[model samples]
Target chain A: MALTRRDILVGGVGLAGLTVSGCAGSPTTGGRPIPVQGATAPPGSPNLLVIFSDDHRADHLGITGEVPFLQTPALDTLASEGVRFDRAYVTTALCSPSRATLLTGQYASRHGVQNNLSAWTPGTPSFFDSLAAAGYRCAYIGKWHMPGDLPDLPGVERFVTFTIEEGQGVYRDCPLIVDGVQTPRPGTYVSTDLTDYALQWLEETDDGRPFCLVVAHKAVHHEFEPPDDLLGTYDDVAIDLPDEAFTYQTLLDRNVWEGTAGRLQTSYRRYCETLLGMDREIGRLLDAIEPVADNTVVVYTSDNGYSWGEHVLTGKRWAYDDNIKVPFIVRWPDGVTAPGTVSDAPVLNADIAPTLLDIAGVPIPAAMQGRSIAPLLRGEAIEWRDEVFYEYFADFPYQVPPSQAVRTDQWLYVEYDRGLAPELYDTVADPQQQVNLADDPAYAATRQELSQRLADLRREFT
Target chain B: MSAAAQSGAGAMPGEAARSGPVGSSSGRAWRIAAPAVISVVTFLAIDLLLAALVGRPWGPAYPLSMDALVLLRMGPVFFSGLIVWPVMRARGATRAQAVVGILATPLAFAIVSGWRAAAFFPPLEAAYYSTNPMVVGAIGSQVSSAGVGALVYALWRARRHRSGRPVSSGATPLPISTGWSWGPIVAIIAGTALTVFAVIWDGGQHLFYPWVLLYGSLFG
Candidate 1:
């Protein structure tokens, strides 16, 4: 008989049922799942806990010393107890595309989620599938903002997410979908509510099998709505607006270009407050998993960085450091040899999946473009890439142009489409990228070299 | 003589002699229609100029960008009533007719252009503009400014009528009046002060810092 989609789906479900039942008997085999015949992971594989935040810039953390007044004790503690990647970035600075890179361990160009409007490429191999096939239970709980309807993602046993406001879930009282069932959660803050679901899943599914939990928070993204407790937390804090942000022309330009309504200072305060709320929830999750804290690998990072009045721009998707850089913190007492160590080697969001899979003892797929940073965590002195590549496709209705960039230790080169002038900044001399050296005769050789390197990297990656 | 001509004979001297067939239905329609057309043209001209200044391409290619541009454009629509009020009053319109013409400017512009915008954009995009508090506030600001302009016009006309001076014909009349009440003056002062405050407070440190430095030099 010819097979239909329904038949395939039902057959897959039946196979999954059989697999679950087979593993049910050996749930508690020496603090790990017994190698059920074809299982890939051995005994004592660590549980994976990934807490992903939205639009969190690299310098926003209290430990970064960039934002002195912004208090983020929980993230500071996590960084102090684990490895913090000092030069972490997203290949694409938008939300959906960067998230797709995280899932597939591939660039946005390969994954086909190049913009916020694009959905995950169906049938693409994800780390979740690899981990599940290797005898690990995985649950994804939080904001799933890809454009197409919430996907029936294979290998994710529990899919708890929301689809309101085009998947940019509300900060308060966001309705959720738990295991494909509509669940209303009224008066619950989204950050707290998602963490609660993560904790609940962790508690109920503690069957001695290693698990992967992703708790993605919708805080610090648009509307800048913090919880009631943190609403006025930063109102008294003085906001030092950038020099470029002090001009009326800059304010008018940003207001029209980015659709940002209020004062940048006020919106930035609310953003910080909302981030604090998200950090509080992260602390709660950390406290809940204290029993297995030593055995659990917690990875905390944001999908992308946000530009807060940097270069007179508000919001992300630019090739600037404020937009492409993200805060990457990983904690695993069992795996990482050196705690409180910071690696200055550049890392991309695409590296996250392969790194997690490597930590879980799953073989890294050959197709994943990102390299696992397991050696860096182990304090092994290995050769790493000296520069990072960044790409941003212009999403509709946003005035930003499509651009590609390459950032090295000393220089940052950016090329724009739509006839805009390319930009080159000497990071050693001007960290804020105030002076453009693209047209300067002095840096002509540097610009040419970086441009060629960018072209080569795009060809090699794509 | 026809009834229209007979009625025109008894009308105000400036009103009957200013233009073509002043008492006819078409003339009355022109009274409202002309100002509405002028107001929409003025709005479009300003939008086009601002779009050019901002380097926004002129098309429906990007709906949200256009929506934001439209919202920003609405901030200056307050000047539409201010611009048209004098023209309507100079053309022998009474205070009621002038106010009606000024009010209908924004209403007519919104209905016509909003319909065109909706046709080109998606329903969700339209709904975003309608439901956004900032966009709603812009609309409110436009209407309130027009209302204030009408009230000012009415007060000026009342003061002129009480002083027994003939309203202008063919030339725009200044809003100057003798023995004018304090209500409109207070309202004007309060509105101007609020506008200045909003610009300074929300305009980041550009306008605010200058005022701060000035105050410090003067008093600090």
Candidate 2:
């Protein structure tokens, strides 16, 4: 049948309206249980697959308006199919510290992984162990930047992690440690290779027991390198620099603004390119798990938020929003009914373990600092913490001074321990944090209150 | 130059003889162009106001002061004005037409620029944060400037009327056919030099430095 212009226009509009209204179909749930011999498992223990990316900021997602032209269809599809947390943050913006928080559900101080160099001694309790104890099979793949001497862990039966280029992991030709065995990879793209192992495990794992899989991608990090196929996809696209880039008053003393601004476009383009490759791999993973998708609780997030000179600084050690805020999207078909939902309630990397345990009906350890946000995911009203504590103990020789901050919904109080002036921002009014109200007489009362609250938080967490 | 010398005294400047002003008698161009210019100016003013309120820096920090930041923010808007003025003048727009264009700058500036910004950031969030006094103050300056522009145009017209000169399109024909002007040629040379310096000194991102900065802020 021949279609008229009006018909086409109407159909287009209708399709767009549906997408905007989140008309994506809900996943199937309550399937027949897979029987396991000699296992005392709860009726429907859903599988868990956590897809973690390194140094990815929250806004970088296409839906977040980070880079306007960058299209992350896979991630956008995931958010539309699940719940996206708008205020998700990391305890520390370093790789190891943040990863440790995800593992232990505790702050850096409690976990003893204060810096990137600090190691988590083998047998230190993680929620993975709890899942294993509850008759679930666990596997970890890709950039396991968590510090530890032993390649083996309590629950992770398959440990396929990359360790090359001083633990940053290489984009290409990277070596992998597969269950304590050294494997040389020649000219293999790291993310693709890691996914290969993860899919293999997902396919070969004993079907009786529910599984926990971690797939971490080392894309979109510093020295941004995309796969060969994606290298020139964004070469012609123009990037709009921010207004602050012109008059970078914050970097005037350092003489680094011009240098940073000049290379910003090339660096950011490479970043988007790399992210695209990762997104493609994620789509493949989703395809591979299509049958069990509804019964699996899929979580996607980053170890830490990264910065490409938002504050005239490149890297993630700072207390800025871009450096600490991370994209957090969780999809559990059986449990979460509110599809395409956005949660403004504060959540942290430390909350991952407790929440996963809660999902699996396991008891949260008393030692865990984070409370499970399972109720929040189910769209239930639950009393939640108003503030999140953030700490970055000095990377001493690197000159990154130690700082602790308490970020409430309205206020942000940062105290630098190196005798630097404190920073206080009324986030509701000044989201970009241009004006520091720390020393302002008008905000003296608010400052004191936030300071006291911060002190109390430090005492509670430490 | 030869065209202006041949035409009568009422002829406007800076044009080829045949292209002085199209359809001047019907006033169609002025009717179309006047509101458009006013709308743009008003939108830019509002954009600046919202920018101040949001306190959102569009790009990375540069090595410039607060005053410099303010100037850089205003630069593009002013540059657009430079292009708009000559077009309206050449169209033989009346004093009232020019006044309407000038006076309508702030609101138009806010609406247009605000719309553009909303595409990148949430409109409500952008507007909510833009409730700063500094943004209001910036809007005030824009409105005041537009008011001043209208006043100047009115005063000039009144003076011409009092002197019994015909209310002709005030544009004067430029004498470019005789010889090239030193001013524009020198500007072109300077601009070329600056671009060359930008390519060599500023990370080689773009040949034109300001364009690089502008593009970088919007999409980078």
Candidate achieving the largest DockQ = 2
| True contacts recovered per prediction | 0.00, 0.19
Error of 2 at A36 (Å): 16
Tell me each candidate's RMSD, in Å, in order: 13.7, 18.5
Model 1 Cα lDDT, one tens digit per residue, A28-77: 11111112222645688888888888999999999998887898899999
Tell me how many clashing residue pairs each candidate has. 0, 38
Candidate 1, true inter-chain contacts retained: 0.00
Query: Tens digits of per-residue lDDT for model 2 on B117-198?
Result: 3433345533432222222333434333433333344344456556665334344222322322343344334434443443
- Among all windows of 10 consecutive residues in model 2 chain B, the one with the lowest summed lDDT is B172-181
TM-score of chain A of each: 0.90, 0.87
Q: What interface Cα RMSD is found for model 1? A: 16.1
Error of 1 at B93 (Å): 9.6
Against the hidden true structure, what lDDT does model 1 obtain? 0.69
TM-score for chain B of each model, two decimals: 0.44, 0.36
